[model samples]
Target: MKATTARGTIEAGDVGEGRPVVLLHALALSGRLFDPIAAEWAPRRRVITPDARGHGGSDWDGRPFTGEDMADDVAALIETLVGGPADVIGMSMGGSTAVLLAQRRPDLVARLVLADATADYGPDRVQTWAERAEKAVNVPREKQVDFQIDRWFSPSFVEANADEVRRVCDIFVVTDSAAHAAACHALGTVAAVGELGTISAPTLVMVGDEDYATPPAMAEQLAAGIPDSRLEVLTATRHLSLIQRPDVWPEIEKHLDA
Candidate 1:
């Protein structure tokens, strides 16, 4: 369904009907990236997965946007469509947005699950993101796939899961460079760790030990900053651990149940 919120028209998947849970995808990925999560959760809870503006079926304003801006969009979504506060799960760039949502619009969030995400990407990291933004804007899509695959998965995982790698690579190749570049630039602006104390929602921060993009150290920092949050490190997985490792779901389910 399409939701006309403060951010504009958002294309979303609203499935099941119970306690609400929203899943946010990483940069360059649309709501489709959460197909597995949605399928699993839809059997019990109301699962909402929206294509963050500029990706998939959503409309982009054709300008640069920030994590806070996207968070506002989600705020409007839950308020106007979901009818109350909702649990939110975010990964990568989406996780940054979730943090912003909990900070800036606390009333809209019930709980937060930040997977393979960070609250701060320092100056050096910002420079790296800027370089990535440049590449996303200028490099050919075909060439970008390898770069993404290297950052998203470990070498062993890639060799063992060729089909999954290809599936994600297909997502990378078709992503809109301008949108991806804008998000990359937005990532440089994240600095939420300092204000994490203001968040009151129950928060769970998880990361893959092998995730180079947002390593376990980043998850540790996020957990330390958030008032009483917990951190879990999933071993033998890379950036996209949720999909790569199914065993983590039981732990995630326990968090949500709590």
Candidate 2:
């Protein structure tokens, strides 16, 4: 259903009834990306997934943004619908937002699952991200997504799971370039490393060993920075391991369900 929040009309779903557990989608994806996962958890937790502004059915609400701004959007939704604290799981860009949610609005989160996100982006990384984003916003779409896709999946993943890669590739291609660009710009500005040690919630950080976009080393840095957190490396998978690997969710269920 659509509900007005601090940013705009926030598109969200609540499929179960219990302590709230919000799932945050990655940069190019909408909450729809979590439909399967949400269904799996619906028997117990209140699985709420919102299409981050400018994504899915939600409004673009326009322009330059940051991870903190995205977290604030989530905070507004929580206050309006959830009534109290909720457990949050964020993947990719969403994972970065989860960290901001913990830092900016601590009481809104009871616990957090940051899957494949990082708390640091040095100057070089920031510049590269900014350049890519700028191209998305202005440049033609000739070969924009090529480099990105290469960075996202390993050669073996593409070779072994050609079918799965094609499906995901279709989804990625359909995403709007402007929205993708804005999120890319936003990610470059977010620095959660300074506040990582202050996260008071139980946190779980996971990554795919073959994930090149945000590799296991970056995920390790996230785990190392957080005072109380664990780093898990799912073997034989790429950036989208949670979706690509068949047996990954059972282990994920342990941490998310607990």
Against the true structure, whose lDDT is highest?
A: 1
RMSD to the true structure for each prediction, in A, is 1.3, 2.2
TM-score of 1: 0.95
lDDT tens per residue, model 2, 204-256 = 89898878777898899889988878888988666665666657667666775
Report lDDT per candidate: 0.86, 0.80
Over 4 Å off, model 1:
none
Candidate 1 per-residue lDDT over residues 1-258, each given as its tens digit: 889987689989899889898888888988878777788878888989998878877899789887778888888888878778889999888899899999998888888899999888875867888898999989998988877788788788888989878887776677888989988888888888889999889999989998988988889989999996998888887898777876787787788879
Using all chains and alpha carbons, the TM-scores for the candidates as numbered come to 0.95, 0.90
Judge candidate 2 at residue 132 and give its lDDT.
72
lDDT of 2 at 163: 72
